[model samples]
Target: MSSILTNTSAMVALQTLKGINASLSSTQNEISTGKSVATAKDNSAVWAISKVMEADVNGFKAISNSLSLGESTVSVGRQASETVTDLLTDIKGKIVAAQESNVDRDKIQTDINALRDQITSVVGAAQFNGLNLIEGTDDVNVLSSLDRKNDGSVSASHITVSRQDLTSGAGTFGSTGLTAAAYGTVNGATASDFTSDAAGKVAEITFGVASLAANDTYEVSIDGTTLSYTAAGTETAADLASHFVGQINALGLEGISATDEGAGVINLVNTKGYETVAVTLNSTSDANLEITDLNGGGAPTDGDVGTIEQRASTIDFSTTAGVNEGDSFKVTAGGSSFNYIAGRGETMEDVAKGLKTAIDSNQPDGITTRVQQDATTGQWKLAVDDANGDGTSTTFSLAVSAGGTASGGLFGLDNIDVTTNEGAAAALDNIETMIQTSIDAAAQFGSVQGRIETQSTFISNLTDALKTGIGSMVDADMEEASAKLQALQVQQQLGVQSLSIANQAPQSILSLFR
Candidate 1:
C-alpha cells in the first residue's frame, strides 16, 4: 500500500483534480455561450426541441411579411373600390339633374362621362406589387399561419381574398355559345297596344238560391283579403248577395267596388291602374256560389276566375339551361339593338337586369323596362312596356348568343345617356346599380384586409411567445452558472494542492531508504 512505484495517494488526488478541471471548463463554456444546451452533446432532447421552436419562429416571421404584403394589396383594392363608388354617386347626381326638362342634359352627360373615366382610372391603378384584386375575378391567397401538428409536422395556412371586377369592357360576343332557345324565350304578343285610359277589369259571382240553407257560410276572398257571411234560418239569394256587397264596400279596399245586380248576382269592379285584383268565392256547400264571368265569360264553376295582366311584353329566360359567363342577350326595338353580356357567376336575374339596363340606355319614347321573377317557377323575365298608353303598338324581339368574352362588372356605364326624358329615367336606375356594385366590392376588400391585419398581429405575438419558450428550454441560468464556476475553481485548486502533498509522501519514503 505504501510502495513508491504505485503512489496510490497521488494517483487518487490526480483523478479528483481531473474531474474538477472538467467541471470548471464546462461551467466556463456555459458562461461564454449563454446556453446550457447549445449542442446535441448538451441535453440533446431539450436542444432539439428549442431548435425546432426557433425554426418555427423564423417561419412565422416570414409569414408576417406575407400578411403585410397581402394587407397592403387589399387596402389598395378597397380604396379604389371606394373611389369608384364615390364617382358613381356623383354620376347619379348628374343623372338626377338631367331629369328636369328645362336643364341642359348634354352638359350633365359630359360631367357623368368624366366621372366614369375617373372610375376606370382608379380601377386600373388599384394594384400592389402587380396584384390587382378589383380588376379580375381570380382569388388570391395570403400566407397566414404555420400550423404545427402534435407529431412535429407543419402545414401552411392561408387567407383567400376574392377579386372584384370593375372594368367597363363591353365584351365580345361568341357565335357558338348559348343558343337562342337555351338563353330565353319571348312570351305573349310581340306587338301589343297599351291603353292607359282603358276600363278596369270586371268579374261576376252568382249564388244558387235552390241550395240555400240555414246558417250556410259563404266566404269570398279578394286579393288575399277574405270576407264571410253566415245566412239566417231563411234568406233568399238576393239577401245573401246584398249582405256580401255591403261587407265588401265597407272593407274600404282601394280601387275596388262591389254592387248587387239583383237576382243573386254580385259584380266586382277593379279601378286600380296597372294592377289586377284576384277574386275567389267559396261556400260551405259546394253548389251555393258560382263564378260566372271574370274578365272573360266561361261556363260557371265554383272557383273559376281570370284576370287581365298589364299590357306588357315579357322575355322569359330559359330555366332549363344554366347561364354561363360571356353569354350575350340582345333586345331589338324600333330598329335599335341593345346588348348585354354576362359576367362570371351571374344568374338569369343578372341577365334580365343587364338587358333592362341596355334597353334603357337609349330611352325610347313611351318605353319602359322591368325585371320580374315567378315565385313558383323561379324563372326570370324582363318586361318591356310601351308606357305611352296612347294606344300605339311597339314591336320588340329578344335574341341570345354565346361564346364571347364576358363584359366588365360596370357594363352599361358607357351608354348612360340622359339627354331625353326616357334616357333620364333609365340613367337613374342604372347609376344606382353601379354604385351598389362598387360599394360591395369595397366592403369585400375591407373585410379581407382586416383579416390579414389580424393574422399579422397574431403571428407577431406568436413569434415572441415562441422565442420566450425556446429561451426557457435551452438558455443558461447565468446566476447559477456563475456560482458553480467559483465553486468548481476552488475545488480544482484544493485537488491540485492535495496531489502535491500526496507526491511528497513518495519523497518521505525515499527518506526512509536514506
Candidate 2:
C-alpha cells in the first residue's frame, strides 16, 4: 500500500475528477442550447420522438399555406358570382318595364345587352391563380391535415371542393339508350286506350236509392277541386246528386261539364283537350256511398291514362355506362327544350330524377311529371304531360338529342334581344333563371370557403399543440439546469483539490523509497 510504483489513491482521485468534468460539460450544454435532449447522445428515445413531432409541425404549417390559398381562390369566385347576380337582377327590372305594350322596348333592349356583356366579363375574370370554379366542372383539393400513426406512418388529408359552374354556354346531350311513347300514341277513340289525357273519358258519380238523412255530408273532389254537399231536410240521393251537379255547372270551372247521364248517374266530361279529369266521392256521414271502379272503360287510374286531357307521356330510361362525366341530353317538347346533365359519381337513377325535376319545373304549360320504375324489368320511367292540355295540336312532338355543353347558365340569356315583343317576353324569364344560377354559385362557393376556413383554424391550433408537446419532451427546464450547473462546478473544483491531495500521498511514498 505504501509503494511508490502503485499510487492507488491518486488513480482513484483522477477517475473521480474525470466523471465530474463529463457531468459539468453536459450541464453547460443544456444551459447554452436550452434543450435537455438536443442530440441522441443526451436521450436517444426522447430526442427521436421530439424530432418526429417537429417534422409534423412543419408539415402542418405547409398545409396551412395550402388552405389559405384555397380559401382566397374560392372567395374570389364567390365575389364574382355575387356580382353576376346583381347584374341579372338589374336586367330583370328592365325586362319588366318592357312587358308593357306602350313602352319603347328597343331602348330597354340596349340596356339589357349592356348588362349581359357585364355578366360575361365577370365570369371570364373570376379566376384565381388559373383556377376558375365558376366556369368549369372540376374539383380542387386543399391540404388540411397530417396524421401520424402510432406505428410511425404518416398520411395526408385534404378537403375537396367542387366547382360551381355558372357559365351560360350551350348545353350538350347524350343518349339514355331508351325510348318512351308520347301522348296520344294510342287511338283517341276508346277511353281505356288513352292515357291521363283522355279528353272524352266519362267521370261519373252515381248514387244509391233515395236514402233519408238530414244534413248527411258527402265530399266530391274533381281534379283537386273539392265540393262538399250536406243533405238538408231529409233529401234523397238523387236530389243531392242533382243539386251538386247544378252547383258545379253554375260555377263554370274551365274544361269541366256536368250532365245527368242516367237515373242517378251525374256523368262528367272534361272537354278541355288531352288532360286528366279525376273524380272522387267520399261520404262523411254514417252511410257509405259505393264508388264503382270505372277505370278501364270511361275512367282510368292515374297510371292507366288514355289520350285525354291531363295525360302523362311515358319516358323510359334504359341508361348505360361508358358515359363521360359531362355527358347530357336535351329534350324538346311543346316549344321548350330541357337540358339534363349528369353529375359526378351519380347513378342512372340520379340522372333520371334530375331530368324529371328539370322537365317539370321549366316545361311549357303546366306539364307535370310522374316517375315510376318498371317492377318486372327494373327500369326507370318518367311520365310527362301538360296536365291541362288540349289534344287538338297535332304539331306537338318530343325529340331528344346530344352534343350539348352542360352549363349553369340561364338558357340563351346572352342572346336576349328585348327590342321585339316576343324577345322581351322571353328575356324576362331567362334573366330570372340567370340570377338564380349566380345566386346558387355564390352559395356554393361560400360553403366551400367556410369549410376551408375551419380546417385552417384547426390546423393552426393543432400545430401549436404539437409544438407544446415536443417542448415538454426535449426543452430544458431553465431553473433545474441552473441549479445543476452550480452544483457540478462545485463538484469539479472539489475533485481537483482531492486529486492534488492524492498526488501528495504519492510524494510521501516517494520519500519512504528514498
Candidate 3:
C-alpha cells in the first residue's frame, strides 16, 4: 500500500478536488446568469415548462397592444356618434322653431342644413389607423388572449366589434325582384283621397257548412265584446246565426248594426267615422262552425271573420313574412322618386316609417303620411293623405324591389327641409329617428370599448402573474447561490491542500526507495 509506483492516496485526493471545482463552477454560473435552470441539460423538465410560459407572456404583450389599438378605434367611433347625436338634437330644435308661422322658416332651414353637414364631417373623420367603425357595416376583431390547452395545444381568442353605418348615402336601387303581393298591398285604387262619408262601409260574415256537435260553443267578438252560444246537442247554422244577430243587436253598440241576411249569412255595417270594427269568430270544436269574409271572398278562417273597412288610403305591409335585408320600398310622388332599402333585423314597421321618411324628405305639396298599426291585428299601415284638404290629387305610387343595397343609417338627413308647414311637421318626426340612430351607435361603441379596456387590464395582470410563476420555476435564489458559492470555494481550497499533502506522501515513498 505504501509503494512509490502506486500513490493511491494522491489519486483519491485529486478526484475529490476535481469534484469540488466542478461544483464551484456551477455555483458561479448560477450567480452570473441568475437562473438555476438556464439550459435543458441543467434541469430539462423545468427549463421546458419555463420556456413555454415565457413564450405565452410574449404573446400576451402583443395582444395587449392589439387591445389598445382596438380601444382607440372604438373610442373614436363613440365620440363621433355622440357628436352626431348632439348635432341632430340641435337640428330638432330648429325644426321645432320652424313649426311657428311667425318664424323665419328660410333661416331655420339654413341652420338645419349647416348642422347636417357638420354631422357628415364628424362621421367621415371618425377613423383610427384607416379603420372607420361608424361609416360602414363591417365588423372588426381584436386579438385578446392566447389560450393554451392541457395537451400543449394553443388557440387565439378575439373580441369582435360590430360596425355601425352612420353615412347618409341613398344607396343604389336594384332591378325588380320582390313580389308586390308577397310583401305588402295597396288597398285603395285612388292615391290621394280616402273616401270618407256619413254612410260607412259594409262587411258580410258568411258561415260555412260544418257538422254541429253536442256541447259545442261558438264565440264572436265585436270591438272587444265577446258573445258566445253553446248548442245542446242539436242546432242548425241558421239558428246559430239568428241567435248571434239578436245578441249583437241587443248590445245597441253605436255606429254598428247586424242583421241576418239569409240561412247563415250576417251583414255587419260600420257607420263609425275613421274607425274600424273588429269582428272575430272562434269555436270550441273545429266542426261546429266556420266563418269567413264574404265580401272579400277569402277562405274560411277561425279568428277574424269579417272584411276590414278601409278607413284611409293605405299601403299595408305584410307582417306574416319577416322583412329581409336589402328589401327596397320606393314611393313615387309629385314626379320624384324616394326609396328606402331595409337593413339587417328590420321589420315591416321600420319599412312603413322608412317610406314615410323617404316621402317626407321631399315634402311634396298636398301630400302627408301617417304610419299606424292595428293593435289587434298587428297590421302596419301607411296612410297617405291630402294635407291641404282641397281634394287636389298628386301622382302617387308605391313599389317594392329586392336585391338592393340597404340605405345608410342616416338616410334622409340631406333632404330635411323645414321651410314649408308640411315639411316642418314631417321633419319633427324624422329628426327623432335620426337622433335615435346616433344614440344607439354611441351606446354600442361605448359598451365594446369598455370590454376591450377591461380585457387589456386583465391581460396586463395575467402577464405579470405568468412572469412571477416562471421566475419561481427557473430563477436562481440569489441569497442561496451566494452562500453556496462561498461554501464551494472553501471546499475546493481544502481539497487542493489535501491533494498537496497526498503528493508529499508520494515523495516520502520516493525517499524510501532512495
Candidate 4:
C-alpha cells in the first residue's frame, strides 16, 4: 500500500511530534507565568469585579487616615475643658477670701483680678493646629459616610466639637428664671451637740475663727433659720459664746442650747430629739477671710477660714454685695455641691457652670436640673434631671426668647442668670439644669467620635474582605489552563495524523495496480 509519491507514515509521525511539542510548550508557559488566565480575554467578569474591589480598598485606607485625624482633634478639645475646670477651682479660693472684713479687701480683689486674667490666657492659648475649643472661634466636624440602604443610599456622619466660648461681651446675658424653688438644710450635728435640761435649752454651736477684728458681723442660719449678731466690743472667747447662746434662744425653739467648753471650742446640745438640724456660719466682713466648715473640729488656724473639708449646699457669695452685668461670681452646685464660678473672663459656656453652682448652693438636697442649648437661638434652657427622683419638677425659661434668639454661645448658653420670681430654689435649679445641658453636649461629641472610629475600622476590614472575594472569583488558575492547552494541542495533532493516513490509502491503490 506504500508509494514513493506520498510518505504518509512520516507525515503522521511529524504531526504527532508537533502536537507533543506544542503541549510541552503550553505546559512550560503555564509553569513560568503561574496563572491560568493572565489577561482579560481569559475571564473578563472576574477581572472587572477584582478591579472594583481594589479601588474600594484604596478608598478605605484614606478613610482610616481621616478617622485618626478626627480622633486627635477631639482629644485636644477634651484637654481644654479639663484645663478650664482646674482654673475654676483656683478661682474659688480667691472668692472665699472676699467674705473677710479686716483682711484688706482691696488686696484680695487685686489677687482675684490677676487670677481671672490667668484663666483667660489659659483658655485663649489652649489650642492645637489652630483649633481652640475653649477660647471660642473653633468648630470641629469629623466627616464620615454611611450606607443606609442596599440601594446605595449613603448618609454622611458628622461629629461637631463645640467651642467653649468664654469671651466677654455685652447684652449677651440671658435671663434664667425658674418656677419652683427649695432651700437647703444646714445640719447642726457637726457644729456642736445641743442639750436641754429643766432650764429649757443650751446651744452648742461654737465658731472657730481667726482674730475677729472690730466691726465684724456674724450670721448663723440653723435648721433653715436666720440669726444675726454684731461684735459690739473686741472679739474674745466669752463674747462670742454669749452671742451664740442669745441667738439660739431668740429663735423661740425648744431643746437646742449652746455651751462654751474652752478657748474657741463650743458645744451645741440638742434638747429636742431631732438630729437633722445643724448650724451654719456666714461672715459679713470687709477683710479677706475664710469660713471653716460648721462641723470642722479643733481650733481655727490661720489657713482654716473657708477651708472646705466637707461640702454644704448653701452658696456663700464672695461678692455678696450683688453683681452688676459685668461682674463674675463663684458658687457650688449639684448633689455634691461641686464648686464653680461665673462672671468676668467667663464665656457664655462657663456661665452655664455658674448657673449649676447657684442651683446646688440653694439646696443641700434637692432635684437636679439639666440644661440644653438651642442651636438656632444659642440659648441655654433648663429642665429637671431625673424628674422622677424627688418632688414634682416644673419647666422654667432661662432664655429671653424661645426661637431665633441669640441666647447660647457655641459652647452653651451665655449671659444666663437664674431669677427667683419663680422661687429662690427654682432659680438655682434652673442654673444647674443649664450647666448639665452643656456637659451633656460635650459628652455627645465623645460618643460620636467613638462611633466614627468604629465605623472607620469596619469599613477598612470590609474593603479588604471584598478584595479577597473578588480575587477568588476572577483570578486565573495557571496550572489548570496549562493542562487544557496541552490536551487541545494533542487533539489538533491527532486530527492531522488521521488525515495523513487517509491520504496514504489512495497511494495504496497505485501499488495494487503495479
Candidate 1 residue 460 Cα shift, in angstroms, is 0.7
By summed lDDT, the worst window of 10 consecutive residues in model 4 runs over 189-198
Q: Select the stronger candidate by lDDT from 1 and 4.
A: 1
Report the lDDT tens digits of candidate 3 across residue range 1-514. 6776877888999999999898888888899999999999899999999999999999999999999999999999999999999999999999999999999999999898899899989998999999999876767998999999999999999999988888888776767666767778776534333333223456666655444678988888888899998888677777878889999999998877898987877877775544667888887775434445432445655544554453345677898978777888886654466788987677898888888888888765666777889889999987765434343444456778888888889989999988888888888988888899899999999999999999999999999999999999888999999999889888988998998998888666556657
Off by over 4 Å in 2: 175-308, 311-327, 332-405, 415-433, 510-514
All models, RMSD in angstroms: 6.9, 7.5, 8.5, 16.7
* Candidate 2: C-alpha RMSD after superposition: 7.5
- Give residue 242's error in model 3 in angstroms: 28
User: Alpha carbon lDDT of residue 452, candidate 4?
Assistant: 72
lDDT of 2 by residue, 208-250 (tens): 5467477677777777777888777567777777877887788
Candidate 2 structure lDDT: 0.68
**Cα error, candidate 2, residue 370 (Å):** 14
For model 4 the local lDDT of residue 87 reads: 46
lDDT of 1 by residue, 2-110 (tens): 7878888899999999999988988899999998888989898998888888888989989989998999999999999998998998898898899899999889988
Error of 2 at 210 (Å): 20
Q: What is the C-alpha lDDT of each candidate?
A: 0.79, 0.68, 0.80, 0.47
lDDT of 3: 0.80
Ordered from best to worst lDDT, the candidate numbers read 3, 1, 2, 4
| Worst window of 10 by summed lDDT in candidate 3 | 191-200
